[model samples]
Target: MDKRDLVIRPIRAEDIGAVQDFLFTQLQELFAQDGQAAITDDVWGLGKTYLEPDNCNMWAVFTPEGTVVGTAAICAYNGRIELLKGRYHLPTTAEVGRCYIDAKLRRQGIGSKLVEAMTQFCKDHGYRTMYLHTHHFLPGGFNFWQKQGFAITIDQGGSLEIVHMEKIL
Candidate 1:
């Protein structure tokens, strides 16, 4: 089906299983090319937990007929509260991750829509800043994040060079 027949919306509770399946499929495809070291149980667990509305914010892209086609999540983090001090030190910050669109629907604007939706979600959730990390090797990921106004904060070498980017909300 054409991507134009799709709609994007907040993830519903009933959609969790489908979202997870989509996520696993995408991850498997990624690993098939990059190798298994890139996949981790922790990452899988985190994705599952992040779908819970109370724990994290997520958005799902679905076909007009109701099939989920993409998913994104904003995992929050705060750098201010000195754990030793037990006090707040800085504004809330969030890390955007688990952004995956069905391979067939890529380049059809679904990815950008998901990012924009997540950014709005972060803003509504009171996040003062948002950050995400992408590898330099993922075809167009680095450039795409840059186009979206995410500044590169770090670059580490490997088959995949980690590139961190952030924007203040």
Candidate 2:
């Protein structure tokens, strides 16, 4: 199918299984795990969070035929807010949980659509800021975020291999 066949929309409960399948099966096959092990079904209460009428939700890019190709999600974050001890952060009242696009469809703006939908979702839900982390190793990982207007709030690019980025809504 062509890019014109794509449709961006909010993710639903029925789509969870397919999303999880893509994450565990398709993604695992594409990446070199290096014995790090495949992903498990335990998603730290993702299903419950999605089901709840809370600040957490997911969005997907799909074909007109109903094939889900990409998704982005967020969850309420009541964890911590150190880093600055002030209101300089992205509000960071919520956390960007998962965002993924099909390998063959990278750079075609599907990811951007997902991110846009999620950011709008946060804004509609009264979130002032959103925080997320991505691996420095991924190709275009940092640039994609930077291009999306997400600033590097915290660069924990040490041995952890993750760089935390935030977008002030």
Candidate 2 Cα lDDT to native: 0.71
TM-score of each: 0.81, 0.81
Name the regions of candidate 2 deviating beyond 4 angstroms. 26-32, 37-45, 80-92
Regions of candidate 1 where Cα sits further than 4 Å from its true position: 38-48, 51-55, 78-91
The residue pairs in collision within model 1 are none
Per residue, candidate 2 scores C-alpha lDDT tens digits across 39-90 of 4433435477664757778777787878778777787765554654464333
Q: What digit string (tens of lDDT, one per residue) describes model 1 on residues 85-150?
A: 222223567778778887778777888998898888788878777877788766677888888889
The lDDT of each candidate is 0.73, 0.71
Candidate 2 clashes between residue pairs 3 or more apart in a chain or in different chains? none
